[model samples]
Target chain A: MSTPSSEQEVHEHGVTEAVISYPQFLWKALGVATDGNALFYVWMTALTAVWLVGINAFAHQIVQGQGLTAMTDHVSWGMYIGNFTFAVGLAAGAVMMVIPAYLYHDEDMHDVVIVGEILAIAAVAVALAFVNVDIGRIDRLWHIIPFIGRFNFPVSMLTWDIIVLPGYFLINLHVVGYLLYMRFLGRKPNPKWYIPVVLLSIVWAVSIHTVTAFLYSGLGGRPFWNSAILAPRFVVSAFVSGPAFIVLALQIVRRFSDFYVGHKPIVTLINILRITAVVNLFLVGAEVFTEFYTGGSHVAAAEYLYFGLHGKNALVPWIWTAVVCNVVAAGIFLTVDPRKNLWIIDVACVMTLFGLWVEKGLGLIVPGFVPSTLHEVVEYLPNALEWKISLGIWALGLIIFTLGLKIAVAVFTGTMHVDAAHDAGEV
Target chain B: MSDPSRRTMLKGAGATLGAAAFARAVAPITEWTNDLSVEGFLQKHYKELTVEDMSAVLARIERETEEQYGAKVSVEDVRPTPGVQFAYALNLSVCIGCRRCAKACHEENNHDRATNNSYIRVLEMTNGSLNLEHGTVTYDHAVPAPGKFYMPVQCHQCDNAPCVRVCPVEATWKESDGIVVVDYDWCIGCRYCEAACPYHARRFNWSKPEIPADEINPDQAYLSNRIRPQGVMEKCTFCLHRTRRGKLPACLEACPTGARVFGNLADPDSEIRWVLENKRVFVLKEDLGTQPRFFYFFDE
Candidate 1:
């Protein structure tokens, strides 16, 4: 709430000049997040219920052992690791907005770029949660701590992941937190404070996803993942899924709130998706050609994924579904214009999101181990408990994203400034 | 507009409910943690342990094994002998696919009785084909069924071990005697090593291993046959508990067909060396350049 004079000032200058201390800013942000409309309450409640169920299931997993999941020694890394890989791409994909907004100095993108950064933070949190749940010894997690634990640095790709994923999370958090705090204080954010970090985040985003791809590709034992093009495919497909998610998110934000998100940013995202989706398809085609054409013992896993190996084709349908979804989505993005046919863009975006989820999550990870290294065919599908844990992680991420957006919207719309409560005589 | 005291009471109630829910959500982790000891949680890596630290660790393990499995076990920290690098030579010509080697590994390593877990997997391949991709591990009819030759595979303990390289915590490493060993206490059980292993030699403890009291192997090495905690990776250490003490590996000793030969590679007169010199010998997946200490040979 604000008095007439302060409200006029906000209308004229887009902000009040009054600044608050850091702790006060955080306290006010928390207040803004907690205080929301009825829809916010319903959404929060739903997410909380799912998250609690997931937590209980995870606790059950911990008590019972990882054996409760469908994972075996043959397919040791399963849905948990699959979801982790996909979420890392989502986090990295959030940098797409950053590239246009910060690097190219696009004004429309700059206004909505904070939304992408917030999504990155939430995505990284989800990625870390999946990793935590997947590990066998959650209690012994301290063993990977760099100083105290015997961290096998410079050798283990996982250790590299441990470094980059958290590093990306912190970088995005710092950028988003600083910008929001400054906005809440009604002050113009200094370019020097966040510019370098923003630039670093763009590079760091690519590194996080690349590191994740390398985690699979670096393993020589699994020939399905031992390709040089895996990292490229990861980055390119991230571009597809990342922009698709942002497009859907931005539409939701525009519909729900009074924040002035123009069609320009949505068009920008669609344009990115158009190119990346095709490139992603090209990479897939290239990889498929390389695998099938070579046709050796190394092709066993790919054969199992695409055309069922030895009467055990659990993943064949899944891969084909991804291919169809991706091809159809790319076609829509290439032909349909978001300016006239906005609903069609939404459809295409959802399709790509599902397509990339299947492609990156199950289609990629499962095949790498289906025909085990010793040529034994052992198919894996995530059981009910694994699905519960994954859904819970998604719910937790949504909770973080929703709360973050609520606070950001309040600050961006000039409703929760430093001196507004004081001016309204409510302090 | 609302009453302040009533609002405070409501806030307190909400906080209490939240705490209860959080505690319930984390109950499994807490219950799991109850089995973990502070000393065990803080135990140093195998390479970092001092003589005193190792002795204390061994004592702690023995105590824990007694408490958990109800089996009185002697856990020893066996050091590798100098100038003695172990190599295994299996005579493919004599192997009949009885899977006695796998059974021997199960008993010798104190594997879970439910899974019948073992470090070795014996594949029955068609007579003319050397491709492991064509091999099958689940054949049930009989010993070396007609037109099939048996090949038993286990950890190669490679000079360039991918499992060792990929471990995020350095929990597994190759020792001086050309044997790869895992410090089960230190492994975070990410199973990255399991995925990196081409041999499918590594096994994971899906749950607490079940062994009857009388059947439990009492003679254990801290890094070898001792019962591993749930959710860690274990593999063949070439029976280092016995081999380091100048004894044969249980798998080699149990071979009724004399199919397996083991000895110090450094000793020129060793039987393994003689097999390598006299017979046509090869390592599995040699093109991967794992430089395996384990070899297979066939007589003409």
Candidate 2:
């Protein structure tokens, strides 16, 4: 553990004069992750169990065929794709913390910005998993690899997604890795390495969500998604979910750990949530107005989503539940002050997260295929296997997040550092 | 040499055991991969394959078909004709609600038996409307029910096909003959093309197509009616295997009332050209600008 005198010495010297090698730092990080409290072990064990169940379901899906799922020719993409879409939004939302911390130069935000980046990494991993599971032939995935495979670049928005998503993941990994490594060495981090990358990540984050929205909107055949406002709506909704998730994460970190998260950062995040939640609701209103008011042949999907079409109304309840959640959450965010009543903020954050998941995931992707292209209404609902698989993916994501946060907290708090044995030639 | 070497050996043994355990855990994936041959996995896209490569691929497919389905199928690599482009037209007034063409497509294209799958869906619509939303494919009553008319829809083989445009791997594309086709072997089976097509023209093979060995179509073209593998996209190719060999589509020949017209649009005297010139023929959802090669005309 670092003492006051040692901390003073580090500040004065600007860098640690005696530092251990990279390997030693990594060894220490592993220790930090593995050596945790009883609660951490239990949580990790539960997550692993769920993850195994998911893998089993996915294997069964592969063996039995995608026919085991509810997807048909009419509704070709279902739970996997819907979850993939929502996870991408979550990944994009993580940049909200980055924007405030880096652009605004808020010192308090800088202390906890790593949480958002780690979440981004976890979210992207989950997104990729959803995509892998959704694929009809996961073995033939190499066909889309550029040069080695016939990648339809520039023409296909999916290709753009393939490039940006992993690109964002790598970028965040580099930033987080570099920062943690510097902190482990008790050395001052050079802005040259991480600053340019952080700036690139912000722009890359927006591009990823925009490109994802374009994947749907570019399809002129699906008039339900063929709207110009979709890209902006994706961005705005991401802002809502991202900050709401961060606020909850920050609260949890503060409650459980000894890490010093100041009041200012939470307030700053709440302020961001206030504006984004309203803007998200406004975008939803605008989309609903345009879809219903026009009442054209294209309105069949929207009608199916909101008011039910003919006799089938599978999605009507889902959209309304999302609407109620968003409205209530946004109202709470606008009125309640986080300083006085913290539980209210937690409630609101959970609501917004759930609301946005439904809004962006099933509420968006399913409707595009309902009242399918030839005007036949073939409703899709994700079966039990799909739910089990989805739960497993979420568990995998939480595992990543938990392990990442543990290492980050350890490094940031000066509890994990390079062993002095490295300098003594014993390592 | 003493303690450290012993520890290292034990670590190696532990790693091997762990790897073996992991492999056993994922035994289902290993079992699934047994059906996928190394040659099939490494095969190139349809357009990129040379003559030798195509013949080899076609032979591989034939061998696989024989082995898997116990059927002796002849799969060929058929190319487009130099001076011909195909077009189809349907006489809406004459078309009865009976789905003989749909049935012919199912049998001719070697569709899955359990799903009773076909490229064509005959929508029974009310007489006073052209709106497809009001149309129903679930009608079970007698043929040509008094106030109802039927419209059979399939792949239009559109010149500007949304299905072709949205395919992330160029697995589906428009041939030089203006017919949209899918290289079923190359498709990643993301089904993006299925969602992109307004006609719902594309079908995904959710499971292994379960056609009996005796019922399998022996004359198969690699791009047209060859039975697709599970987890790929397939669509109507104007029965190009038959069409390129100077024959009409299976659906056209199967139509009871001569409602379907198929011919080379490049030929000035073709029947499809005469229909387009003489009748008020229109493409479905023309405002989307897909420029479909299939047309419909009502006898007024």
Q: How many residue pairs clash in each candidate?
A: 0, 0
Q: For residues A164-216, what per-residue lDDT tens digits would candidate 1 score against the true structure?
A: 99999999999998898877766688889899999999999999999999999
lDDT of 1 by residue, B1-300 (tens): 467686557656755876798788878787787888999988899999999999999999999889888999999999998899999999999999999989999999999999999999999999999999889999999686889999999999999999999999999999999999999999988999998998998999988889998899999998899998998999999999999999999999889999999999899998988999999999998988889999999987
- Estimate the lDDT of model 1: 0.90
Q: What is the TM-score (0 to 1) of candidate 2?
A: 0.94
List per-model TM-scores for chain B: 0.96, 0.93
- Give the true-contact fraction for every prediction, in order: 0.87, 0.75
User: Residue A71 error for model 2, in Å?
Assistant: 0.7
Poorest stretch of ten by lDDT in candidate 2 chain B: B17-26
* Segments of candidate 2 deviating more than 4 angstroms: A1-20, A421-427, B1-25
Worst 10 residues of 1 chain B by lDDT: B6-15
How does each model score on lDDT?
Answer: 0.90, 0.89
lDDT at residue A331 of model 2 (Cα atoms): 95
- DockQ score of the complex predicted as candidate 1: 0.74
